[model samples]
Target: MKSHYKFLGTFLGLLVFNSFTLASFSAWIDPYNVINSRTLPKFNQLKPQSNDDARRFKAINVTRIKPKTIVLGTSRADIGIDPEHPVLSAHAPAYNLSIPAGDMYEAMRYFQHALVNQPDLKQVVLGIDLVAFEHREDVGKLDPEQAARLETTSYVQHLPSLVFSTDTLTSSFSTLTANLKGEPVREYYLSNGRLIRFNPPEMPIEAVFGLHLKSAYFESWYKDFQLSQQQMDAFRTIVETCEQQGIDLKVFISPAHVTQWEALRTSGLWSTFEDWKREVVNITPVWDFSGYNSITTEPLTEEMHNYLESSHYVKEVGDLVLNRVFRHELRTVPNDFGTRITTANVDAHLAKIRADRSKWVRRNADVVQLVEQWSRE
Candidate 1:
């Protein structure tokens, strides 16, 4: 009996030690940036796993910073918009709460989280994504993990999944191994809640654009794409919430390369895209940047100087976006780069876009042909 008691005691001790060990490992590696206890170089600072886990990391960040101003959208804004930009100072202490592949629902939840933390939230730069506005019936369900993190006040409630799961352990190992191997840093999450993504230096911009052009994500993105009522409702709520909260808001549509516009037309979603713009204008006056302009029509360069791909632009363009919307550095921004559209002028603005599209389509036959080929694939 004494020996049996001794064995049980030993087993319990080992079990407790093992649990502690696992949790410690998870926290140290911080695979998802949940327990950011120790972020040392060659160990865990740059998080490649983070792009997919953006919702959780971003949710945690808003809780920590409680920023008064924020930019909201998908990876477009995540990669481009600067929280530290001078134009956003009208509403001080801005945070870029944008996440990769984020839909309107996810964006609203994060915005709500920000509001919960900072009730006196001042100003906002809400970048709208046409792709995110589409509701895919195939992926109708919210991710359970992201849903739980957004639901809970105390993130500790979700620590078991983050700190004790086997998958997390795998991630921890992967992160450590990546550091040990000295892998190229693809992305880094800043303390100010902005995310920085790096394209491979060896790869030319055309290759990057081709990768995006051939990307299955974009191929599937416009599949049966229609404007989602739920997403539109969420967008409306975000705009209304700002009005009700006495928060100043600026809205802008993110710009895409001409190839993407041709692809949208090829997908037979051009009418729907135009309708989406009208719907957004109805909700609030917005800066329309997703059109054929000198900026968006920038030829594919040797490096990612202007646009990252057909969809995402670099931070320099984002700065130009801020300057245009916030009415700063007007000399730097071309006149046609961004147009402010309201109920009164939306029709004229869109008509002008159609005219411009005609000219752009004529000028870029090769790009149009490329988009056509990619769409057929």
Candidate 2:
């Protein structure tokens, strides 16, 4: 009996030592800065972790910073919109909360999280993705617990990473060793929530075309999925919540490249897209930037410079979007690039888009081959 008691005591001692060893490992990795840092690591030094996990981890930090202005969208805004831009910061200290594949439901949760932390919040700029407004039949394939986690999670809940979580141990070791060797870290996203994607020095036009052809966005747009009522309801709630909270809200449709615009028209979703714009404007005034304009137009023959691909425009275009919407000044935007959409003129504006696209198609007949080739694949 005495020997057995002594053995039990030794076993408990080993368990306690092992627990501390794990905790120490967790702190060593601290990739998200969730455990040991008072503020996030230097924005440039921070790399992208699992973006979904990164977004969840970053949500806690953003609330702590409590910036008065927030930009919410998918990866388009993630890479495109800069919170530090003078125009955006002029209104309020801004933070970009955009995430990859982030939908309205996810965005709304983040916005609400911000509201809880920022009592003095002033403005919100939402870059709406038409795809985000579509209902997902299979939402939880990746990170199946994301919805519940985001809604109810607090920073404290994630602190188990500092001790017992095996994920923390693995990630920490990887991040530490990678940093030492100057390897390209998966943590390409900064603490500010901007995703600086690593693009090759020279991406040829054919590669760009291949990327768009293979992208899920291309297939989804081709399917001509209509916006669901549930998505609209969530969007309306976000708008109304901002209004009630006295936050200045600005919503904008991102400018797609000519190839993408052509897809929308060819898929017969242009009318549906127009309807979405009209509905959005009716909810509140919005800056309409979709459709074929000087901004969307690209020479079919030459390698396009302004766009990263068919859907993702570069930072220059992002600046133009902010300038047009906030400054009401067309810095790089052609006079026809955007309009202040309202209920009265939305119908006429959409009519103009159809007419303009018709003319655009005539001018760029070469696009038919590109489209046909993409459709076949």
Candidate 3:
């Protein structure tokens, strides 16, 4: 009996030791595999991380990346400007520090985090949205914990090399795991020194029916959303800090479609919010494209007119807005002026396309077809 008891104890100890060894090996191997491997499998269980992750990691890696000008907003600004494009390259080093569905509160938090790591930050291009000013509850989704972690910790001082390395490892792990699991990773992954991803497809009017069905099935959760006043106060604190640090701040209200603008206007709350935005910062160069009502009136080419709502403009329109903001020469103008003028230009461009819609469709038929296929999938 004594001999048997000794053998059982020894076996159990060996089992526990082996388990710890395997867990440790996994921790090291996963990161190593991601950093070394060029191609990783796309897995459905993991949501694919974006190339933006890598770009951001690289930007942080720059030995002296105290960019004088940084762009801030949601995905609209993020996807609009191509970092490698010659126009942006010629300008002061700019980082598109934008995230999907980001709002003013989140932007402010991001600014705070960025400045903490980069003490020499001098200039900022802030993208404002009227909707962001309105009461919202979904703001909690902005990952405040991570932002707070960055705020409290002197990330640069402790792990100078670890800052870039941690970012790289995290991004690679997230992406590789996501690819292994078939998931809707945000479009835009690096391929052959360029970003590539499936484009949104053109949908027939019949597609609207499908959308309606989906909407009906999912209960609307908009009512539960409410913006916290405390968070707004936090943003104000960030602005104050920037001002104290002598950073030049340029605020921009990115363009949106007219239909969307009208919806906001009707919401009774939007007007009050607009007033709030004006009070906080200089309201010039508002990149409001929401006034372009023609695209909603009639569809142009499937490729050009593929957006389901005013919120999602085609890539062409996105580029046009970027070109005007970054490259166009203009006199010293107010924030609202940029939006008004750019809206007119966008309208004109759309009107010209509508004049010969068939010709435009033919010219972009291949792209349109690709878009259509993507939508179906």
Candidate 4:
């Protein structure tokens, strides 16, 4: 009986010791950066893999940075918008609060989250995407659990996972291994919350565009895409809050490659797309950049780097956006790139885009054919 009792005591001690060791390792490595307690150069500083729970890290980032200006939107803004643009930086310190495939609710909620942390917020640059407003009944809604997590993510709230989760321990070990290998960070977010990808994607742009059309457009997002009044209301809340707070707010339709617009038209939702713009202008005037333009018509090639794919533009185009919106010193904006649209001018603006679309279709029938073929597939 004494020997059996001694064995039980030793087993309990070993189990506790193992748990403590793992917790300490995960906390120190801080793989997801939720803890951020212990980080070192060549060991854990460059977090090569994260964003699995982006809502948590991003919320913590906003809390810690307390930026005075913020950029908000979907992945279009996430991968495109530069928080450090000369115009933005001159105005105030900015952080990109956009999320990948972000919905209007997250945009509104995160705006509130930023305001909670930085009451002195001075300016806002918001990118409103057409797809994010979709009802998603034909596809599916955002995960309810993930949506809940976005609401309460902070350092304290993340402590348990930061310490004891087996998944976190695995991530910590992977991070350590990657650091020791001295691999350059392929993709990660900057301190200002801007996303960075060190290398251009190796896949050819045409192939990538096809993947987007077939995988993303066909399989999701564009299927029976219908707008939600509830989401539009949430967007209204963000706009109203900014107005009440006296923040200088600039809203724009994020530019996509011409092929993207073609896909939207082919999906049989062109009228709905136009109506979305009208709805936005009703809420607040917006800078329209989604039509066919010099920037959007750039030839699709891996070497161009103007667009990462059909939807996500790069910093050069983003710079043009800042220039157009803020009237920056360089003034590098193309002649037909962006237009200010209010309720009065929206009808005419939509008409002009339709004319432009007709011209583009006649000129680039091959592109139109590709969109039509892919939509049927």
Per-candidate total of colliding backbone pairs? 0, 6, 33, 0
**Residues forming the 10-long window of minimal summed lDDT in candidate 2:** 36-45
| Candidate 1 lDDT tens digits, 26-137 | 8888877666576888888776666556777788766666689999998889889999998887667788999788788878888887888788899888889888887766
Put down candidate 2 lDDT per residue, 263-353, tens digits, no spaces: 6666667667777887788788888888888878877434566677777777778888888888746555678877888898888888888
Estimated TM-score for each candidate: 0.88, 0.84, 0.54, 0.87
Cα displacement (Å) at residue 180, model 1: 2.1
Order of all candidates by TM-score, from best down to worst? 1, 4, 2, 3
Task: List, residue by residue over 1-377, the lDDT tens digit for candidate 4.
Answer: 99999999999999999999999998888776655466678898777667565666777767667789999998888878899988888556798889888788878878887887788988999999988787744232446754554455354665675579888898889889988999677776655677765444577668778887788877788886789887898889989998999999999999999988988888888899999999999999999999988889877666775787778888778888888888885456888999999999999999999999888878889988987887787
Q: Where does candidate 2 clash, by residue pair? A: 29-172, 47-187, 47-188, 48-186, 48-187, 48-188
Model 1 CA deviation exceeding 4 Å by range: 89-93, 138-144, 191-193, 200-204, 214-218
Report lDDT per candidate.
0.81, 0.71, 0.46, 0.82
Over the stretch 258-331, how does candidate 3's per-residue lDDT look in tens digits? 33333333333344444444444432234444333333333433444524334444444445555556544333
Clashes of 1: 0
lDDT of 3: 0.46
In model 1, residue pairs whose N, Cα or C atoms come closer than 3 Å (at least 3 residues apart or on different chains), thus clashing, are: none
Worst 10 residues of 3 by lDDT: 216-225
C-alpha RMSD of each candidate structure in angstroms: 2.7, 3.8, 9.7, 3.3
CA shift of 24, model 2, Å:
4.8
